[model samples]
Target: MTGVQKLENSKRNKIQAYDLAIHDWYQFILGYPPHLVRHYIEKFGVSKYDIVFDPFCGTGTTPVEALKNGISSYGLEANPIATFASKVKTYTDYDPDLLLEYLAYIRRSMESSYSNYGIVEPQADLFSYKARFCTIKVKDIINLTESQLQVIPKGFISPKPLLKVLIIKEIIRSIENKDARDFFLLALAKFIVKEAGNVRFGPEVGRTKPKSDIESIHSFTTIAEIMINDVQKTKLTGQAQIMQGDARSLDKYMTRELVRGINCVITSPPYPNEKDYTRSTRLESVLLDFIRNKRELRGIKENLLRSNSRNVFVSDNDSRYISSFSSITSIAQEVENRRLALNKTSGFERHYNKIILHYFGGLYRHLKTLRPYLARNCKLAYVVGDQMSFFRVLIPTAELLGEIAESLGYRIKEIELWRTRAATATKMQINENVLILEKK
Candidate 1:
């Protein structure tokens, strides 16, 4: 296939088997595709001078991937649910009976739970709704008493994440269907923003899956029972360490050992996509104690990057930058012309331009923030795409990064086409690409 044809073909196949793939829907949803982290490490290669980091750190993909290669790495995530999920992937020890131990923990607690809610624990519609939405059998859990709920066993002592995760795990363990369980986990994790009332996916595709309240029929059996399976499966050279902190100010949370002698940096910060990372993780945030309370999370909507107009990051004059897209040497202008040819509102053209500039500008700021911490001769890679807007291609991610790095005393090394866009993606445009940079 030609580059365009290859890109189109890859979309339908999800292009996971190819070299450009960083992740897939199955591994996130079903665990069928294997982990992409190991693949990333092998492709990029790590060295003793490398201490990697992912600023966005969605579900800890980078950190978890880093761990397999035994490379010391760091991650920062604003989304509480995603941050926590990433931690679970990192902490899960594939020791024998680890799953069984957690299973036994729940069984003992379930036995006593019979007394917590009393005989009529469940509300009228609660049973019906749970039956429809969740993978677990709600009726079985409803019978547990208040005493059982009150006295959380040692394994379930967290009292917070136990019930929620249990609702899903019980179904995964007990359900005979493998595909259903896997899909359920992905759907559940994806819905966490919505299920837990957190943020939703932005216009960009890599922001992880969208907020979905519905349940899928996929299986949950251990596709790969081993913990850190992604690491070994893909063949990598570093281990992952996911941490929590504000990227604008990363020095506070990251240790000196973690940041010292880092060779490369790779990540994508939040685009201004009207997505409130705070609201998206709201449900999981409350259930997981990732946040103390709803009140503390109230202002998180304000913390998002200016890429989306919904956040505080944008200014009234931001349209000036949006207008500058008229200058790009990209395929986006054809998109605008096509829309105009159709006599459409085509407002997305301008909005997308604003969004793109907002995204790249935010990335530029973050790149500057990260420059001080990276070791000499570091390589930086970014996965990005071009969105058509108002007869212009908005900010060029690679060029913008190059300019920012040059301004910060770095050099532009390589800008290569990583993977062709999958044609079937309803998420965004087909201009999926990657950027590679180096510090001077």
Candidate 2:
């Protein structure tokens, strides 16, 4: 079979057991599968002597996959929570039995404390203002400060379950083993999104069925058990240099000497689909203290690539980077023209064109900055989806990004169709492409 045929077959088949190790610890809502990363790793000829870099490593899939193959890698993530998760998931050397023991101790302590405090499960009431107003005492549990509470959506987490989660977090914090504690937190973050929080993702951030109460300890322990099993089976080796910083300024985080050794890059950056990447991880981010206030949340959003109108700020000037590209400018103008003809003038609707420009511009800047870091003949695969979110104006993301890279003197190897998704408005299947490039 051809390499692409094998990759497509892997995606079609069921997820394998070996693929579910640390890679499944706490993934993004719509992250590419580990087999995809492995396909590119093999195709790029990565080895322990070479280095792979993922500039927008959300949840660390590339790093985990690279480390699993014993390849030295580097991952740069803008989100603090995601950066922490990637680092913990890639780092090894913890005994599975010890991790399980720590989980047992934490669960026991949390349950004992809950029993002592006489904390009962809150009733699920859809319209009980009284129940909502009722505050549970958390003197024995770790209570969130007013600022932290303000950042979380009111109905997403009920009071009783929130208290239990806080207690479990405190237990995780008390662990002396740094690696164990970090792994525990990553598991907790996953449990919070999957089981604890009332949020649901139809691949977008929205409320589904409200969860009034959850057995936080049970949920946390269940995920931890899965993690321990994965640890026991997987022998993690190789170095992963992780950083939390902006991708546009690649040189700031990766030194010139380090960049000269980078041989390959396999990453899936945010597409211009109008989906705010920040909102998908908002609940866990706030609960885990990665974002404590509006200011911090705003700061995090600012560092991200400007792909959505929600994150566009007055200070954004990334469009200047792509000002010379007539095709990008015309695309942005067409989006604005379409919006004006449709008479859609909501705040976000007005900036659809600007979002496209800035999205490509930010990507252009990253590519230009990245040019200095890539070694000669380094192969890079960027997985991006064609977007039609802005009023059915089809955005050929992969093609445009390839153009930007070519303009920077890189060789465009080929654009491969990775997958397809049906666009709701346009009723057309948009392709998610793998744009392969090689440094000259």
What's model 2's lDDT at 272? 90
Error of 1 at 220 (Å): 8.5
Q: Write the per-residue lDDT of candidate 1 for residues 47-144, one digit (tens) a residue.
A: 54467778777666566556555676777876565665666555433333344343333333333332343322222112221121223345654333
lDDT score for residue 63 of model 1: 65
The global C-alpha lDDT for each of the candidates, from Candidate 1 onward, is: 0.46, 0.82
Cα displacement (angstroms), candidate 2, residue 160, comes to 1.9
Candidate 1, 388: how far from true, in Å? 3.2
Supply candidate 1's per-residue lDDT for 319: 33
Cα error, residue 388 of model 2, in Å, equals: 0.6
Candidate 2 deviant stretches above 4 angstroms = 2-4, 7-17, 120-137
Q: After superposition, how far is residue 394 of candidate 1 from its true place, in Å?
A: 4.0
What's the true lDDT of residue 104 in model 2? 68
